[model samples]
Target: MSKANKESLSVGTKIEYRKDFKDIYLPKTMPVIIDVPKMKYVMISGEGDPNGEEFARVSEALFSLSYAVKMSYKSNEVPAGYYEYTVFPLEGIWDLVDKSKPATDKSNLKYTIMIRQPDFLTDELFDRFVKRTKKKKQNPYLEKLTFGEIAEGLCCQIMHVGSFDDEPESFARMEAFCEEEGYVRSDYTHREIYLSDPRKTEVTKLNTVLRFAVRRFR
Candidate 1:
C-alpha cells in the first residue's frame, strides 16, 4: 500500500505514538525486513556530543559510500547490501566510517559512511572519482573535534530496555508521536546512542536511546 495514502506519523509538528513498523532493527550491513518487535524511541535534533567526535572515521564512510555508489551505478541494486542511506550524527561515544565496523552473524554487515544523493555515484559521470582512495590511502578513524558549525533538525529517541533485538515496540511509541506532530520523516537517518554498552553490562538490562531526525512541515 502507498504510505502517502495511509496515515504516517506527523513527526515533529504533531507528536504522538503509534505502531509504524512490525520490525525496526536495521542490520549494520543490510536493510531489515521481518516481523520484528516494537520498542520506544524519540526524535529531535540540535548540537549533540561534540567534544568526543570521530572525524577520520567519518571521512572513511564518505569515501566508502562514494565507492559503493560508483560500483553500483549501472544497476539498481548493490552486491550484498542496499543502495543509498540516510545517516545522522548521533550522540555519545561513536565509531567513524573507517574504524566503525559492524561485526555479527553477518560479516559483510559493516557500517559504511554514505551520502543519500544518488546522482553523485553514477559511473556515467564519476567513475574515476571512486578509485583514488586505495586501501593504503584510507585513513584510520580518529576522534573528531567539534569546534564550529553543527546543524541538525529532528531526532526520535526512546529509553531502550533489554537487548537491541528487542526494541521495535519502543520505536513504535516514538513513531506515533512523530505522526501526530506533523513532522515529515526526512528519510534523514537512524542513530542508536549507547548510554550503556551491553558488552560491559548485563544483557537483561542494557540502556540505550534510539533516536531519529525529523522536520516540521511547512
Candidate 2:
C-alpha cells in the first residue's frame, strides 16, 4: 500500500472496504482469486440497459432508503452494532435475460442492484426505514427494495480501471485464471462494484471491481 493509502486508514470508526477487505475491494489490475463470505444488502431487481430510466429510478430509491436508515441511527435510535461508516458502494449482479445468449449483451441484461448493509441491520429496522422513506418520497420504486443476504463464495476478481464497456478485457484475465486453475464459472450473475461516480468521473477513469463466481472443476 502507498503511504497515502496507509495514512488515510484510521484506527477505528471506519467502514472503508480498502482497509478491511483489501483483496476483495482493492484488487490489483490483474485478476486475483478470492473468497467472498455471505453479506447483507439492500437490493432491487430490474431488466434492460443499466443506462435506462428504470435503472436510475432504482438507484435513487436504494440511496434514499439507505440514507433514511443512516439518519434514523443518527437521530432516533442507533442500532446495536451501529458505528460510523461509509455507505457501501453501489453493486450489481448482472446477467442476460436470455440465458443462452452472452451475458454481455447490453440490451437484454437483467440485474439486481444493491448496496451492502451493516451486520446490525435487522428486518424490523429495515421495515421502519422503508416506511419512513416511503412517507417522505412517495416513490413507488421504494416498494421494490428488499433486504437479504448473499454468499458469493469462491470467485475471481480484478480492478477494472476504465469504462464499463472495457470490462470484457478484465474479465478475459479472470477467465484465463479460472481455466488455468481448474475452476468452472458458477451459475451466478457477474458482480460489479462501482467505486467512482459516473456522473462526475470521466469514463476512462472510472474504477470498478469486477467479480465472477466460480468453483473447482468437478
Cα deviation of 25 in candidate 1 (Å)?
Answer: 21
* Candidate 1 local lDDT, 46-101, one digit each (tens): 23222224433554444453444444423433323223333322233222333354
Clashing pairs in 2: none
Query: Can you tell me which runs of candidate 2 are displaced by over 4 Å?
Result: 1-12, 100-104
- Candidates in order, TM-scores: namely 0.36, 0.89
Task: Give per-residue lDDT, candidate 1, residue 9.
Answer: 21
Q: Which ranges in model 1 have alpha carbons more than 4 Å from their true place?
A: 1-149
The lDDT for every candidate, in the order shown, is 0.39, 0.84
Q: Least lDDT summed over 10 consecutive residues: which range in candidate 2?
A: 2-11
How many backbone clashes are present in model 1? 48
Give the per-residue lDDT digits (tens) of candidate 2, residues 15-61: 77768877777888988779899999999998998988889899999
